[model samples]
Target: MKNLRVLDLTSCVDLLVTPKFSGCKNLAILILERCSQLVEVDHSIGDLKCLISLNLKFCTELSMLPVEMGHLTALKELLMDGTKVEEIPISIGQFKQLEGPIATLPDSVGELIRLNHLSVRDCHRIRKLPNSIGNIGISLVELDVSGTGVSKFPNSIKYLQKLKVLRMDSCFFKEFPPDIGELTSLEEIHASWCRSLEGGIPSEIGKLHNLRILRLRHSTISSIPMEIHQLSNLQTLDLLHCDMIKELPRLPSSIRELHVDDELKSSEIWILDNLRLQRLSTSKLPAMIKLSNLQTRRLLHCNTIKEVPKLPSGMMDLRVGDELKSSKIWNLHDLRLELLSTFIIQEEIQLSDPDLVDYFAAP
Candidate 1:
């Protein structure tokens, strides 16, 4: 037992208590997933100095972890989701990764000052975060609360100055902290599927000079703050399925990917001057004069556009609906470029040239 390195007891529903691991000093991985009857873990589990991964997911009866867990200095990943565990031992602060569906996190969790990543995804019971989380300081690089019931962020979140990635997708939050701008190191924020989010994005987001990607897909936001144009380093912006957005604000020239819906067909979008755009999926086909660098274009559901604008020479993919395919200006040979990969047209639009069809059919 002392030499055992991996132990997987997954789906052991009858397991009531974990065996003492004092004799398995070299055990590096222990999985007790789906042990619905498990009520306690042996304190001797702390004796496995070489243990690196411990998974106790779906242990419905487990409510507490042995305090000696802090002794596992080499532990790196600990997953306890689907368990009844509510209060984690302060010893958990020694771990770098902690994920679960616990109701609340103990303030002692802040002791993990060196933790770089923390995820509580799908923890529907969690409504708020512990204020002590702010004490994690610059070491926290990414924080994910997606699929949780959390409706608000603790004001202390402003202290995560070094956080770079934040994923709150599918959460219940309606607004972001006004001090979100204080997170100067943030690079990506994915709040997609947050249908409850309204009141528009905080203009303070302009303070995120290093932000690279911002997605608010399926939200109820009626307008984007003009301050978003200040994100000079932003490269990707996705607002697809946001039917409430009536107009788009001027975007930065650095943007490479932009996705929007047909609701803005009549809205004036001044993106013709952005030369660096690489991918554009929109219902409005703007004039393409300075778009030599564009690679992909999806002009679907654009029944209002009468004529097809001159396309960029570097386009690699073009997908259009029946309206644009049947236009008098639609010519396959003129668009048959060297870089074109996928040219998707509606089935109703018949192909006149058999050679063009065969070229696309070539594997």
Candidate 2:
């Protein structure tokens, strides 16, 4: 039919193959999602020049797409989230309106100037992104490359004036482009668990006035950029398991939740005019004594104290890790203990490994 605007074959579990679309020149939307048995798509799909949206999600048996699909210049959105497709066709760059993804992307991906959102998460085989990716700077908003082996980011990323969210979790990038501060519109940047990234946060990062959440937990960076104090909208700062960092920097006034290593368990809490800092994990009890609104405190692997130090007056819950074995001095505080939310006690927690469990129980 010449006027076909939409063809929804969703949940066609037995559909083994799709018909050629050579005659449907005006077809705008074609959805074959959840077609469990679909093994292939006809190459004549390129004939549908008016096709704007094509969704082939969860088609496990389908692993490849006909290269002729690239001829659909009017294609705007392509969804292949749960498919077996290993690599994106190089010709796909012709679809300037393409938006998102799953396993792999082609170098031609940089040609999609209109792409707004791209997610190549858990695609371990993709070692690096093409320098051409910088071409999407004009309209690209969100880009996620978590769980890959990408070693570097394009210097052109700074050109993405409209970009907002960027997630690079569990990757091994050596260092971020220093001029990253040029992206003035960035909001949330989650690059946690990137243990191999060497350099600390770029000073330009503080220029992101709209940035709210910055999660760099479990990374190898040793120091925070002094410029971080300029993030006027930053709310959550996570630096957990950052063992190389020697000192914690004072944060912006807007910070509400602060997550760091056990090293800062005793540092002073910022007593600002608008103190939104709430929960913290520290080893020293002195940090907890000053904050009036501090709610939750975790004592992680703190082993030295003979007696539990005084906690914040308004503190609600306290979580104690696998440490503090003293059952004798647990009565250091004589105040109303029943009023606390979760009273932390000294005890040894069981490990997951069989040998480690027996080792902890020995003697």
Candidate 3:
């Protein structure tokens, strides 16, 4: 009876603890996803030497892993995405095949060269990544240190040649490494909201030919290097709340989504023309009615918005600050408006149009 190969008990809401799987010698996959009440796993599960994937996502009650979890020699993928787990067993580094977060990444992490995806979101204690992390460059596909205390990255970071996604939002990284473009496989770089991060972006950013999305929103980035226009594949660029950036350079036509502050001059806004723009957010809406493909428009609060430009008739979503006084100047009765309450400005709005009411709060 020890031949169980796959065990899926996903969404077992009432289950508080994992049963022993020690006897399942051939077990390959064990999925306990969305088991909201699951608090802990029996350490004996470590005996499943052939186990490959263990998914425990959405187990909010789970705060710790069994100390013996590192013994799963053959386990490859371990997902605990939404759990409250604060720390992982460092012996996990001995897993050799382990992948992916918290206070401090053990230096032994270098031992798991099979590690691919690692995320340490909101771990305030970790000051830096283990220099040994560079050992898994060939297999590390994504690395995120968003909302952490990491003030600097190890020099070994330049070795992540195969990495695709690198997000360091709200971290302590004072100055971004200039050699980030060395990660030639990178497709997205989200480093927004780091108040301490103040500096001109490196021109080497242009070297990331594969980059597709770049967000430096609510940050102190002084200005976007002209080299940013070199990102031929970049489709989204967010610089909202960056008070230092006076105006954006002429962007590549590949841009489909752009978010900027209200201070941008009207003259500098028109240069983003006839591209693949699908959505745009700014203080004063741009006159890009020709972006027929544009579906979403978010206008920030601008006290001087005298008139609303003719927006796309096919627009699916329209978000404007409650302070927008030119409501009567725009024609929005025909479009389907979908706006979330969170994006709605905390103010009153007096609108008789039922269509607009769905997206705007009444005064």
Candidate 4:
């Protein structure tokens, strides 16, 4: 069919071979996704000069593509996730968007100078990226290698000055690229569930003036770099399940949310003498005598404290168990937080400001 522009045979499990597309000169989209038994794609696919999208997702047994495919100069998007393809063809640099399960990318990938987003998530065989990756750094905005075998980044990653978001969660990398701080335009970094990530964060990370959100949950990191306090634009920091950290450091003044939970038995110490904060959640209450800017606080499973520190006057919400009453840190009868809306405490303790009960009782 010379006029055929779109041909989608998604999930055709019995389709072991693709028919020659030599007659479909106008074909613009070809989708062969989820064809579990598909083993070969006819080389005549190159005859479709107008092809713009090609999807071979989940084609588990398809290990290779014909070199003739390089003739599809109009192709824009290519998806090969969950396929057995081990390497990308050097000609693949012609595409603007690509997602794959391939083991290695051709060095020609650097030729896609305009390519912005690249994802190789769950590609367990890819252990290293080509140094030529820096060739596309000028236009790349985001890169995701999450759930991949990439244990480290090439030194050339520092050349990605325009990169904004990076995600590598659930990876086994032991440390980050030492020059990670060079990505001055970065805004968010999600590295949670990196259980094997050890060796404290590089001090260069403090140089990211544009960084806003940083999450390193469930990691084995033992300490927070003192340089972290330099992140003036930081807003959210999550450290839940990070049992290895022994002491908390002074965080940025712009922080709005902080979640810290250590091991159930470790004597974790917190040195939270902050400038400004809105939300705080942790297992061991820190010495926040200076957290006057705090608005909300939640103490979870905290039964080891001997005394509770002074609560911020601006506190609007507080959630705690019977542990607070058991500690002799402050006089409950003198507590007069007027803005507290939610206070979950033992009925035996009464606050001096009777108005607090009215806010809590409000719908």
- Model 2, 1-363: lDDT tens digits are 888889999999999989888777899999999998999999889899999899998887888888988898888777776677877687987664432344556778888887888767776667777777888888899988888767678777777788899889999987765877998998999988988878687888878999999888888876778788889999888888888777655577787667765565535434433345454444434434344455554443344433455444344454554455555434333222222333344453323445434533556
TM-score of each: 0.80, 0.69, 0.67, 0.81
Query: Per-residue alpha-carbon lDDT of model 1 for 108-194, expressed as tens digits?
Result: 778888889888888778888889999997699999999888888888999998899999999988876578899999999998999
Judged by lDDT relative to the true structure, which candidate is superior, 2 or 3?
3
Model 4 lDDT tens row, 219-323: 787777888889999998888788777666677777777767634223223434443445555544444345556655555334444456667656655555555
The CA-based lDDT of model 3 is what? 0.74
TM-score of 3: 0.67
lDDT of each: 0.78, 0.71, 0.74, 0.76
TM-score of 1: 0.80
Model 4 stretches with alpha carbons more than 4 Å out = 1-5, 23-28, 47-52, 73-76, 263-281, 287-289, 293-309, 314-340, 343-347, 353-363
Clashing pairs in 4: none
Lowest lDDT block of 10, candidate 3: 340-349
Please give the lDDT score at residue 277 for candidate 3. 48
Off by over 4 Å in 3: 4-20, 28-43, 53-67, 76-87, 94-101, 283-363
**252-291 per-residue lDDT for model 3 (tens digits):** 7788788776677556555654464456665455554344
Prediction RMSDs, each to the true structure: 5.6, 10.1, 9.7, 4.5
Scored by lDDT, the top model is 1
